[model samples]
Target: MPDSLPPPTPGEELIKRIAVRVREARKSRGLPRRVLSELSGVSPRYLAQLEAGEGNISVILLQRVAGALDLKIDALLAENMPLDRDAERMAQVFSKASPDIQQQVRALLFAHSQTELRAGRICLIGLRGAGKSTLGKLAGEVLGLPFIELNKEIEAALDMPIAEVLALYGQEGYRELEAEALERVSATHDRMILAAAGGIVAEKTTYVRLLQRFHTIWLHTSPAEYMQRVRAQGDERPMEGNPAAMTQLKTLLDTRTPLYERADSQVNTSNRPVKASLKDLLRIIEKRRFLDVLDG
Candidate 1:
């Protein structure tokens, strides 16, 4: 008889667990390996090896895979724990639930988690020309709170400009850094005003984390004004050799409206002066008492 195979080593066992989780997640989502490869920027052959437990992927590559799957990295790495099976089933169910139900669930869960995590933190989210940077700065000064631009934080961390970061790491890498920058900001500052990139909503995991950890306000404007303001800021890329840019912008706005509506509040800046919109923002914050911390 053939000699018994040597017992699996600890590292081998860990790799097996990762392989199983990756395969299970991909299959459950009905994502073809090639599609996942495109989303994760990992080669199909690499993904194949990973799923077969014959590849040990780097953390950065693994992060890209997890983001593509809309899963937290820790979820793929955690050792067996009580109720893990039930938790996985619940997560799948939640993913299939209606948006209204998902919102209800998020409220129930985040209410407890946000009591301290979100206290006195405010985040402005919207397209580039929505006045997040200007208004966030003004409001922070008025309220005696710090103001931070999330992209600037990311740039500082990487020691490069936004364009360079994208050129170097692609969208997935930039998003991974975005998520990390957000977490760092949340951990370091309890009371600050933050301006977030408009496309943050496209990433479900990061968007959910934003909602869970800050009082978010969606700032909006008309498509015309959005374009005008962006041009005023010296960013002509939208209109540079793109005759259909306006149409594309409108379509994008329409698509992201639902996602933006998920914010806790909204402030419209259409056809309004800067000072007037600032007043509206301040009034809403006061009326909503977004900064008030309740005692346990």
Candidate 2:
């Protein structure tokens, strides 16, 4: 509806425009097809067939279609003026099909489309408190698969808090633990939602390891929001005022954005509600048939 947009490509757009307009009007009227079918004494399946145009819909079908679509029979038959050639062709193809054939074609097309969009090697990476645990758990639940927090594996193996390990053994020690944990997970062939440390990608070996094994997604946010979300979760120590903290954060974000951009996908959580963000992430995963991608 915005004027700034370019005009849609001709033909296919026309079919979509008509189909979408009709669908929108039907939804706005809030008239369920079942009720319309009952009112017209037509079976639900017959009404669905007519609406979807998967059968030889006739003048008799028009009455039911009109009623279901909450339009006059005349309106149903009204000329879709200047029908786009492509839409017209598509309409003709659909109209010529038997109901069973239409269903088969629809199913095959749907399956093929799904195959193209499925996800590969999914791993969630972000700074501490960027919601790797929360979102990873949610993703796992929604995906009906195992959820793994890499830090948990590290801590379990080292018998210490992650910070303690970092402090006592230093960065190299932590990297070793991280590498080992990553190796264990990489060997397990399954649909797993991994919550990875933010800095892991800075380590060449670990970064390459993750990219090799999982489809990585960066869960990113504005520094201010990241601080707020993290503090709200009681990880307030990171926010201890240092005069250069903001500068450091800015540099980190600038540097990391490029690294994270290497991910299979990136999700910005700054403006979104957590629930909505989780749902969006899940939708992306599902759209890509992430599990199938992993297997491949």
Candidate 3:
């Protein structure tokens, strides 16, 4: 097995960390889970599930977790604590993330530093026609990081077109190829622009592993705009004989939205000019100070 494979029960560890923080906050506030739920407008059962680490929470629920404890949301999700003298400063940084994410981040830093690097890697994801390649290249140039398209790499690794590879090898084979491509990318340069495959986020283990290696940005596009762009790019087959193309596109977008939102930052790419969109994305990255966050 590869060294990068995330160990079993990662979700459980995350849940445990969340539960621990929730428990601590509840006690500190002198409130029971029911009372916390009432104040936060979250259900007691959900809150209990959250406290028990059995829930996969949304950003909103995470905020509610903080609110219920009178703690800031950031504090609840931060990956590390500061030193004794910097304890107060660290506490002000954000909520504590699960130990696993913290460890993952540390492992990433350690692994990456062993390689010497540049401006940190940035990952772009979302549906096709979201301008991940275009904007990712531009953003990478601006930030002085190398640009890499994972799909292109995957194709190169398989020595064939993606469609041909998929058709010949099947979905399972393609996933293995994808994993190998990702592993090769991860082992290479530490700082780069990653224009990732759109559906990578759908695979939990793969997504978490990649997250350990790159700061992710979700570039969102509306289905209408995506369809138009794909058509304009000469891939009109989706629109040709398939009357259900539009419906399927809409459903796919809806399904991926929540998953995409889990990204470090989100930029809606529909309608905006590419240049304008890249600038907005750059500002978002700077605002988040991902470089500093990653360094920590």
Candidate 4:
């Protein structure tokens, strides 16, 4: 008879849990190993070892894998609990803190989880064709705050077209540039209106940071209205004669709705004039004192 395999050490058991979580998440999403490897910049062999619970990974590597998996590390390490949005965000913040700080934060969150975090900076978040740029500019003018488009900032910082950034650096590279641009702009301007790239919510770390550092507003619009606006602007790149374009757009909106919903407030532009929408957004800012208020 073959000898029984020795029990896994405690640390090995933890590693096994993580590996199982990673493999299950990838498989559940029907993502092939090569796809995950490509998305994560991790080798297929390394991912294989990870799935088999035979390889030790560094924190940075684990973070890369988790981000590519569209999961928080805490979820990967969760103790048999199904992950939810609140759990994911909590884990994102908790995992980034020191042990002592984590304890303090736990108590604080328990005591006042409902407390709002409103920063002085105004950040607009939404999908494309939702009037983030147009509304953001108008709001900035009205509020006397400088207007910044994060995409333009990323382009200037990289000194190239965004298409080139995607070609050269990939999605991860673009996210790095996006975060850096946000920091540079936030550092330079004490109070400004920032129109973030539509997909910024997909970057967990950056999105969480934005939540902590800005008064975010989701610019909501109907899928039909969104398509109409996109066409009105002469940008049909998304459709390009695809009959299922609206379906695709709705899918994206549905997937990202939860993330966008995390904003401090929402201003719907559907069935409303741009001026009216801007006025509604301005009132939100006034209520929060987001504009013209410097951080202490």
lDDT of 3: 0.76
**Local distance difference test, candidate 1:** 0.89
lDDT of 2 at 280: 75
Candidate 1: residue 207 lDDT (0-100): 98
What candidate 1 gets wrong by more than 4 Å, as runs, is 1-116
Model 4 accuracy (lDDT, Cα): 0.82
Query: How many clashes show up per model?
Result: 0, 6, 5, 0
Clashing residue pairs, candidate 2?
117-288, 118-288, 119-288, 121-214, 121-215, 122-215
TM-score of each predicted structure versus truth? 0.63, 0.57, 0.60, 0.59
User: Candidate 2 lDDT, tens digit per residue, 1-296?
Assistant: 86697776654454344444444545566758677667777777865654553444456755655565545554444445322335445656876876545544544554545332223347898776567788889878877778888888999988889889899989998888898787776555345788898889889877875775577778888888877777788865765867676678778878887888888777778788889889878877766556674322
Poorest lDDT segment (10 consecutive residues) of candidate 1:
80-89
- Model 4 Cα RMSD, 1 decimal: 20.4
Error of 1 at 108 (Å): 13
Task: Give the C-alpha lDDT of model 2.
Answer: 0.69
* Model 3 RMSD vs true structure: 20.7
Off by over 4 Å in 4: 1-118, 292-296
CA RMSD of all predictions: 18.1, 17.7, 20.7, 20.4
> Could you say which candidate leads in lDDT?
1
lDDT-wise, the better of 2 and 4 is: 4
For model 3, residues 1-296, the per-residue Cα lDDT tens digits are 76796765866676677777777768765788778888898898998888777858888978976766656665556555322224444445423654444444446557755212223667899899898988988988888878899889988876889999989998877777777777777766666789988888887878876776677889988788989887888998878989999999899988888888888778988889998999999998788665553443
Ordered by TM-score, highest first, the candidates read: 1, 3, 4, 2
Model 2 ranges with Cα > 4 A deviation: 1-121, 293-296
